[model samples]
Target: MASGLLIEEGEKMRTEEEMFQMILEIAKQDERIRAVYLNGSRTNPNVKKDEYQDFDIVYVVNDVIPFLNNPEWLKKFGEIAVMQEPNSKAFGWGGDHNEQESYTWLMLFSDGNRIDLHLDIKKVALDRYLEDTLTIKLLDKDDFLPDLAKANDQFHWIQKPSQIEFHGVCNEFWWCLNNVAKGLNRHQIPYVLKMYYEIVHPQLFQLVDWSVAQKNNFQITTGLFGKYYEMLLTKERYEAYLKTYPNPNPEAIWQAIFNACYLFRELGIEIAESLGFSYNLVEDQNMQRYLTQMYKKENDK
Candidate 1:
């Protein structure tokens, strides 16, 4: 089992209170930086503290031109072990959404803290502010920011899916499960699990989360491996989900593969029913059973 080293290290890296103080001290003298706000795990109380926790910060700046031109100004925060400017042509994973005018900097530090700094000339703050749910006003020099309520996880909440969307996820999950079966038959354990994890499992878990989120008002993250799922999920159901990953033997692996098919079929049906979609569990179940039988016959031969 791969231990969660990234999350554990992030908790040990820095104190939130100290980081807040440092940001405030810097903002006091820097006239260009008019306001400071935080986002991501720092604001999320439910998230466990770790060194990998990013400081999702935004600095509402004055001109935003001179600083954007020279990225060195950011080094004042700390000796940057390494960094990324998402908007830069050299590294444009997230391209400039606005014409050449609007600029945002997405940075990851060596200490494992990340900051997504958005630069605006103060004129566009109001319009941009209303559009995003996670925007929190920390310090506003001109008192332009409204008296906002405490931050909530509403932005990250699982939205209720449409019938079409629910069915689409189900279709994708079952389709990918066949790939896992094929990989396992070919003695490719990595290929089998990769498909199982990335495609099939995510769909199953997403629906489960969506169902729970609907019940609880969408306020939690289940973590990557359903790490926090036990809080919301029954122990029996959670254990059942775990059964989908059996020991990696050709004979024993089929039982696990079948369990995945069963679990996904059940969950997908529930999700589809909730959204008023036609559940196709019969079709998926038959397909999964056929795949399992074929793999078993081939192994025997």
Candidate 2:
């Protein structure tokens, strides 16, 4: 007879119910584990449910050191395909790399289940639990978890931009393009792509989100990195947004930059006009001219 604690090998992907049961059973067996709760997409009502979503579980423990010292207990879930202990000294995540106030283990089982599990002392968990509204209590062995409101993504809502914020985004978009231009002109593909995606593109996307918010009354969630962009943007606007992504080649890269500039201009002006905010047309024109000269230079080479 197989022990209930050991998840059988070659088993099909466990259903949510099975996963939850196993999680609770593990907590129940370990007297050190005080309570268990869930966080992230599993707790987000607005997020579409999918098999790919991993369990983001947190266990409030009497003490974290025992769990940290003896991690072999996690094997009860299944054979670990891979795992990461972010708080471990090998990871050097942040701080002194040895701090153990709270610890996290992200694991993927051979049965195709992933769990990002955190162990925190009861005090540490209780003090910071309310900070993320996307949370749900799974088990409370001693009634340690407080009554929480229905889990929501309200904390992730897009906010209305102040005038200063508007100006700052615009300034960042235009100013950073110079770095992209210089990289492109020097035929430094890596530098150009890095600047385009990492530095410049985020500013453009922020403007795009703001424009969407302007139409939608600034009360929406674009779902982290604007994942909802395709759904939120109009067909024409979304198509334009796609053009901002460029291939590694010089011509394609340059064209993508032009495409980005065009989209930013149209959206930026529309937003400024609607909000009665100043749009620095002269600064925009000068940057456009600089981009054209750089493109011409790249072509001449």
Candidate 3:
């Protein structure tokens, strides 16, 4: 909990039951909201309990326009500190949701509770019910939402990578380092950081995911973008991963870049050996030389 949040003195966080009751009570009051269900970490049995887990709720309504028109209805939940309606055209992101079947409001209350509420028409919600394995039907006034299998994180598990995917990951990781080298040599911080984080980092993380999955028999979930990397990876490895993050200092950025390359190469070879896949040593060696030259050139000046 951040000290900056406007929580009243002696105010206590609501329990899970209280939160659920408030959610269900809200739906029960609004005749427009017919059914309610839960998604995300709240519904995943594998996820450990935490204070920050969100209530990913969906209310199956006949029409979403009425709710969209009257935004004040959200006040009934609690004293909201911040909120975002990502599906609303006026204040949204990613897509044009003018004709979309569902609308979402991501709310953060004063007491630190968050709810990612969704308003979906009955037909549209039902059509996609079976798609997500982590779903729990919370309330159904008319029994519209079907009974689902026990929620699991199987859908979120790190899958075993194919030979082609392995090759692609390795190729992309090494190939992108050249761009990082060029950007670093030119003293272009934005371009270098973008290439390092967005382009190179993803390929490295993909290899990490594959290695973790292979070691664990492809039966583990890393909890959304390696959020559980600390818990899943060895302490030394995790510490090394922490070192891969760099500040704007050129020396620190160069060190972070090298850390990422070494981590990627280490994990890449481990995965390749385990799966009997051919690892491209030549690409790795060539990229290492290229980055080293760039590093020396920049520091020598």
Instruction: For candidate 3, list the clashing residue pairs, or say none.
Output: none
Put down candidate 1 lDDT per residue, 172-268, tens digits, no spaces. Answer: 8877777777787788887877787777778878777876776675665665556677777888878887787667676677777677777777777
The C-alpha TM-scores of every prediction are 0.77, 0.91, 0.94
| TM accuracy, model 2 | 0.91
Query: Where is model 2 poorest over a 10-residue stretch in terms of lDDT?
Result: 1-10
Per-residue lDDT of candidate 3, residues 174-224 (tens digit): 998898888888989899898888988889888878888999899888888
| Cα lDDT of model 2 by residue, 27-125, tens digit | 999898889999888898877888878899999987788777877888877678778877777756655753457888898877678899988888889
Positional deviation of residue 193's Cα in model 3 after best superposition, in angstroms: 0.8
What are the clash counts of all predictions, listed in order? 7, 0, 0
Q: Model 1 clash pairs?
A: 9-51, 10-50, 10-51, 10-52, 11-49, 11-50, 11-51
Clashing pairs in 2: none
Error of 1 at 108 (Å): 4.7
For model 1, state the Cα shift of residue 38 in Å.
Answer: 1.8
Give the candidates in order of TM-score, highest first: 3, 2, 1
Native-to-model Cα distance after best TM-score fit, residue 188 in candidate 2, in Å: 1.2
